[model samples]
Target: MLEASLKTQMQSYMERISQPIEITANLDSGAKSQELRELLQEIAAMSDRITLVEGSDDAQRKPSFTIARTGTDISVTFAGIPMGHEFTSLVLALLQVGGHPIKLDEAVIEQIRNLDGDYNFETYFSLSCQNCPDVVQALNVMSIINPRIRHVAIDGALYQSEVDERQIMSVPTIYLNGEKFGQGRSSVEEILAQLDSGAGARKAEALNAKEPFDVLIVGGGPAGAAAAVYAARKGIRTGVVAERFGGQVLDTMAIENFISVKETEGPRFAAALEEHVKAYDVDIMNVQRATKLVTGGNLVEVQLESGATLKGKTVILATGARWREINVPGEQEYRNAGVAYCPHCDGPLFKGKRVAVIGGGNSGVEAAIDLAGVVAHVTLIEFGDELRADAVLQRKLRSLPNVDIIVSAQTTEIHGDGKKVNGLSYTDRKSGESRKVELEGVFIQIGLVPNTEWLKDTVSLTRYGEIEVDAKGQTSIPGVFAAGDVTTVPYKQIIIACGDGAKAALGAFDHLIRSSVDMPAEAETATA
Candidate 1:
C-alpha cells in the first residue's frame, strides 16, 4: 500500500484523467491477494473516474489485475504487486489507462499503433531490479497504444515456480508468445526493432540522410550529455548517437558520489541528464551503435552497426565502459542462467542459494556483503594475495556470518548443467591446487573495460584500449576528442565524466575556431 504522501501525490496525478478507467482484479484469498486488494482499493479511492471491479477467479495468476479504459481492450496487467522500482510503472499504467497522454515521440507512437502482428509479451522482473521497470513501462505503453498488443509484467520472485521451470536467472527476461524474446533492459525503439524486422533498416536510412553536425557525440552517458548541452548552448548544430542513452550508467545502481545530488538511482539520474540535454537544441538518436570512425574526410564520419554513416565537423567520443567479464568456460554459456554481472540487480533471484563473487576489491567485497543478506551463502574469490577493499568494507564483510573470503584464488571455469550454473572451479595461487565451489550463481565484480574497440586502428590507444587524451581531452586525431571512461582520465566516476565531457566540448570548440582561423583568406571566402 502507498504511504500518505504517496497517496496525496497519486490523487494529484489522477486529477489529470478525463476518461473512465476500470481496475479488474483476479485475486484469491491468500495474504498476498488480500494485500493487493487493499492496495487496489486505496488506488480506486483517489479519483472519481477510477473504479474497482471484482472479476472472476479463473485467472491463471493470483493477485493479478488489469487496468483498462472503460469498454476498450486497451489494457496492461501486473501479475504481482508493482512496487519498489515498478512503482512508477503502476502509476504510469493508471494515468495512461485513464486517458492521460504518454510522453513519447509522435513517430514512435504511430509506429506502435501501426504494428501488424499479434504481440503477447510477458516480462519476468524482480522488484529490486533497476532495469525491469523500463521494459515493463515500454511494453505497457505499447499495449495501450495498440490493442492487438498485450503485455503482462510478472514478478519473478512472487512466481518462483514459473521462474524455476523456465530456468530464469536474470531480471527483465522478456518472452514473446511463450518463447524467449530478450534477456535485459530494452527501450520502446529496441522492442519495436525486434518485433518489426525492417525498423532497423528504416532507422539506418533516416540516420544516413541527416545533415552533418558541428559537434556529434558518440555516446549518451553523463559525459556525452554534458558535451551535447555545452555545444548546443554555443549556437552550433549538435547531435548525439548512442547505442543506448545512459551507457554504463544505466547498469549502475546507487550513485551517492555525484556532487550536489544527495542520492539518486542510475535510471533516474540518466533520465534527468537526458531531460537536461533535451532542453537545448541537441538532437539525440538513441540505440545507435558506432562501429567505425573515419577521420580522413573534412567531416569526420562515424559508421554505425546499422550501416549508417554520421558526419560531423568535430566528434567527441564518450563511448564509456562496460563490466569486465571473466572469459572462462561456461561463463558465457550460463550468462543469465546463474552467471550475472550485477549483484544488486540479480542477487534477489538467488535467494537462499549459494553464490560466488569474483574479485576482492571494493565492488566484490561490497557485493558479497550485500548478497550475504539475501543469499544463503557468499564466497568471495580474489585473484590477488589479499583483499584490496577499503578497511571499513573489509570490516563489514568480515562481520557477515554467511560470507567467506578467499584470497589468491583465480576463477578458472563456471560449471553448469547446460541450463543453469551449479558450481565453479578455481585455483589457489599459493598451493596451485584446484578447488570448486558448489554454488547456484557467480557474480563478476571486476573493473570496467573501455568501449574503445571500434577505435582500435583509428585512434591512438593505450595498451588497455583506453583512448589517449591530453589535458583538454583531445585525442591523437585532430578535431576528434575523447572523454569519460573511454579516455585516459584518472577516475571513472559520473561527476568526473561530466567534467571531462565539458572539457572535451570546449577543446573541440577551440580546435574548430583555430582551424577556421588558420584557413587562407581565399579558402575562407570560398567556404563562406
Candidate 2:
C-alpha cells in the first residue's frame, strides 16, 4: 500500500518509538481485510518494538485494527485503510501510542487527561477529504490521553451500510456516544470547547489578561501570517488572533499557483505558514474569532466572540473570505447531508452517483470536470448566459461526456428527504420556467464572500462587503489597515495576499512613526 520512499520515511519515523506497541487486527474473509493485513504486516516490519496480532471475530467492524500500548487501555481504532490525508493521522497514532511525546501545548494535554466521564467517539471520514485528518488525529490524541475516552476513525466508503443508516452524506462526520456530534473540520480546541462547557470562559479570561500588542492581526491566512512575520521582525510586539489560523486556505486542495513553490496542498502550505511565523516573535492565538473593532485613541480594541477584548496600537485586518453559499430552501438543511461546497473534499463520497455543480465560473466548471471522472453524471448550472471559466477549462469541461451544461439557470431550492439530498429545483431565466433535476449531491462553486461583515459599519466596505484599502493597504480608518481577500485588492490569490499583507504592516509602522512625532507632548503622554 506504501511506496518504497514512503516506507523508508515510515521506518525512520518508527525509530522514535520508545515502548512496545501491539496492533490487533479484527478481520474476516474479505478483500479489505486482506489489504489491511498486508498493510499491518508492512508496518510491523518497520519497527521491532511493534507487533501485529489477529483479533477475535466478535468485533463490530471487520477489516479494522487497534493500536495500543502493550499493557494500557489507551488505544485508537481504524475501521479502514488510513491512507491519503489520514496517513499522517496513522503515523501520529503509532508514534503517540508507542511512547513518543505529543507536540500539543502542555495545558491542552493536561486538560484532556483530566477530563471526567466515559466517552465514545466515532468519526466517519473519506480518504480524499483534506479536512478529515485533523478531526481524526485530534480524537485519536484525546483517546490516548484519557482512558475514559475511546475513539474509532471509520472510513465512510468502506462502511456504506452504516453511512446509509446514519444518513451521512459528508466526510468527517463525528458521532459521540452514538449520537451525532458534529460535521466538517474540527480542531482539538473546538472539540474540547464542546465537551467542556467551562473551557471557553477559562480561555476568554486568559486572553483578557494579555498585554496590548503593537500590531494585532485578525486573521491567519497567508495575508495574516505575512503581516505577523513582517511586524514581528520590526522588534515590536505582534499578535495574530484567528478563528482557525489557516482560514479558507485549509479548505483549499491544490495550490500550484503559489510562487516559488511548484506545487503544494492547502493544509501543508498552511502548516508551513504557521511554522514560518512561529520562527519569529509573533504570539499566535488560534481558534479565536474577532466580532468587532473599536478605534479612536492610541490603542484599537478588538472584541472577540468569547467576550474577550484585545487592544493593539495598530490592527491589520486579513480575515480573508469564505465560499459563497446559494442561500435557498433546503440548502442549509442538507448541508453536508448532500449540499457541499468543496468538490475536492466531498466529491469521492458521491462516487457513481449523479451530482450537480452550481455556478459556471472557473470553480464550478472545474468541479464539474473533476466530478465527471468519479460520479455517474454532472449537471453544471450557470446563472449567467455563458460560462466565465477560462477557455481551456471550458473546453475540457465540454469534452467530458458525462457532464451537461445549463446557461441562465438560477438555483431555487435544494430538495432532500429530511436526511439526504435527492434533487434540486431551478429557474430558467429566458423561459421563466421552473425545473428540477434528480441528483444525490449539489456542489456550490460560486466565488467567495469577504469575511468583513463585522467591519461593515467600522470601515469603508464595498457593496459586496470587502474592505476598501488604498495603495499602501490602508483602510478609510487612519490607523487601521486591511489586506488579502478582505480588502479591495484584485485577483484574490495567495501570492498577492502575502505582498499586500507585508505592505499593510509597513504602512502601520509608518503611521506609528508619524503619529508619535506629531502628537502633542501631553496628549502623547496621556495616550501612552
Which number leads on TM-score? 1
For residues 88-128, write the lDDT of model 1, one tens digit per residue. Answer: 99999999988989999999999999999899999999988
Each model's TM-score, in the order given?
A: 0.97, 0.96
lDDT of 1 at 427: 95
> Model 2 over residues 1-528: C-alpha lDDT tens digits?
789999999999999999899999999999999999999999999999999999997999998999999998989999999998999999999999999998889999999988889999999998889999989999999999898999999998899889889988887899999999999899998999999999999999999999988789999999999998887777677899999988888998889998789999999999999999999888899889899999888789999999999998889999999999999999999999899998877887898899999989888999999889999999999999999999999999999999999999999999988889999999999999999999999999999999987886789998989899999989999889999999889999999999999999888777876776243333223211
Model 2, position 147, has a per-residue lDDT of 85
The true-versus-predicted C-alpha distance at residue 2 of model 1, in Å, is: 2.0
